[model samples]
Target chain A: MNELSTLANRLAEKGKESGNGFPFEVNPIPGEVEVLQIVIEDREELPIFISVSEEQILCMSYLFKQDEIKSGKENEINKAMLIANISMPLSAFSLIDDQYVIYGSLSVNSSLDDITHEIEILSDNILESIEAMREYLN
Target chain B: MSLITKILTALRGGAREVGESIVDKNSIRIFEQEIKDAQGQIDKAKRDLTEVMAKEMQAARKVENIQADIIKHEDYVGKALADNNETLALEIAEKIGVLQAEADIQQKAQASFENHTNRLKGMIKKTTKALADMERQFIMVKTTDSVQKATAAITDNYASGSSKLLTAKESLDRIKEKQADLEDRLSAGEILQDEFDGTDDLDEKMKAAGIIEGDSKAQDILAKLKAKQG
Candidate 1:
């Protein structure tokens, strides 16, 4: 299997052992470098995707599309997210194509526990981040 | 140009054309090529480092050989002086002087070579580290590019279909709902626990009011004795 798939397996096992009440389901996306979609229980709407590179392990989730924002509030919302980015812990905000994404990255050498912690933190951040930007949504 | 500027330029090129990814595969390919070029340069520097080191060793050997010649000639001068041959001793001393001059030249060359070798080695070491750092950055850029493309594809699919894509507001709403649900569950549990604890208190109150029997163990023993007596 690919690097992401292997990481997904490790994360799945970690979820079982942690018993922090949030369960995980990992699904692999076939490609040149495999991507894994990790759906955390109770936070299924914001599923985190894991993308592995040779040097970085990236965990990201999509927030909303640009068109979903109020028409005139695009620039305003961008500034808001940029302002919120600094205060948000462990994750940052970016616009990929047309969708806004929140992501956290670690070195490829990071342990399974660190990766799992990153995922959990990202999952939590997804909600708070979206809520912070809720005023701009349509 | 700086890496950030290069990346931004590539992204700008892709953005001009609609339907193309902002950081398309071509840009990533270019980045990968750049990383490969950096790797090639580091490899060449390593090769050059070895050549410089080899020259340094040669220069050092030449110095050592010149010093040995001067030492051997000094012995000859001493032997000639011991035979009481003044003319022969003077000639040998002159040869020793030539050897010393040659040794000076070789020693200078060896020191220069040593300095150059050290400088080259330091440059190669620094360049190799920088190349590794660039390669790592390239990988991250490539991964982010690929992730963007994948996310775009998924978003497009969802946009074109009847199934609405989940919005930020909706996600936040769901989170709130889950939190509310958890809160409700916790409160319910607390209520249940309170009732459990309150049951003992209620029973004690009832016994005090004589509405329910209390401490019936002694009464049961007395009844058993009465039955035995009868």
Candidate 2:
């Protein structure tokens, strides 16, 4: 198996055995690249997708769709995202295929604890980001 | 064209029939190809380095052999001189001159090999760093591509689709509702606690009706005593 597939399996196991208060629900997305859909309990609305590449492990959560932005608010929302990107801890705002996503990148050699911590922060950031962007969202 | 330029061009010209996917496929292929090419270059450079290193070792060995021969010949010249054999000593000294010249040539060759090795080492180092940078950037691009594809596989429209992922609007609505409900529940708890405290209510009613004097201020009481005495 590839490094990503192995990491996916380890993350799933960690999600099950972790007693660190952050419970995760991991589901593998079948595709060319090993992608895992992870949902943190209580923050079920936002699901984070994790994929490991040659040098990095990326964790991303969909923030909103471009069409979901309030009409005529794209410029303002885009600016807000750009500004917030600086202060957002460990995550950045990106537009991918008309979807706005918040993603964080970690080294492939990051420990499981580091990955889990990143997930927890990412989950919190997703909710907080949505809340912050609520005024501009439809 | 550059990858960014190609992607931008595709985006601008209208991707009529899943053109975005086609662009993605092409770009991913390009990245893979580029990465492979870099790897191949690194491999070839390492091979070249090895060859250079091997030559350096050979030159070093040759220089060492020549130096050893020169030292042995010098000893022979010394023995001839000690025996008062001037002709023999002169002949041995001449042989030493030839060996020294050979040693000097080999030493120059060894120095040239050393310079080549250093250059190759520097080149390899630079190439390796560049390769690492390219790989890191590829990771970012590849991960983003995979994420976009995975999301697309589930549903084109996340809000109306059956996917578990919720749009930020819906999530924010739910969060607001939950917050409002929490506020309501907390206020209700306070009201219920007040209603359950029967004696507190009785005390308030008594104070209002003057059936029980409300806790009098010390200043008020003192003033009342002074007025009565006066």
Best by lDDT: 1
| Candidate 1 lDDT for residue A9 | 80
- The residue-by-residue lDDT of candidate 2 on B79-138, one tens digit each, is 988999999989988988988888888788888888987987787788788788777666
Stretches of candidate 1 exceeding 4 Å from the true structure: A16-19, A30-33, B12-58, B61-86, B97-112, B115-119, B126-130, B152-164, B196-200, B207-230
User: Number of clashes in every candidate structure?
Assistant: 0, 0
What DockQ does every candidate get? 0.45, 0.30
- Chain A TM-score per candidate? 0.94, 0.94
Candidate 2 residues lying further than 4 Å off, grouped into runs, are A1-58, A67-73, A106-120, A134-138, B1-58, B61-86, B157-171, B190-230
Candidate-wise lDDT, in order: 0.77, 0.77
lDDT of 1 by residue, B1-230 (tens): 76667656766564444334445668678877877887788788778878877887887888888888888988888898899988999998898888888878877887887888788778778877887887767765766566655565445544553324556787678768998998999999999999999998999999898888889858988999999999
Tell me the lDDT of model 1 at B10: 65
DockQ of candidate 1 relative to the true structure: 0.45
For residues A1-138, what per-residue lDDT tens digits would candidate 1 score against the true structure? 356667778787877766567678887765544677787877777788877766577788888888989989999999999988989889999876566889998888999878888988999898887877888898
Model 2 chain B is weakest, by summed lDDT over 10 consecutive residues, at B14-23
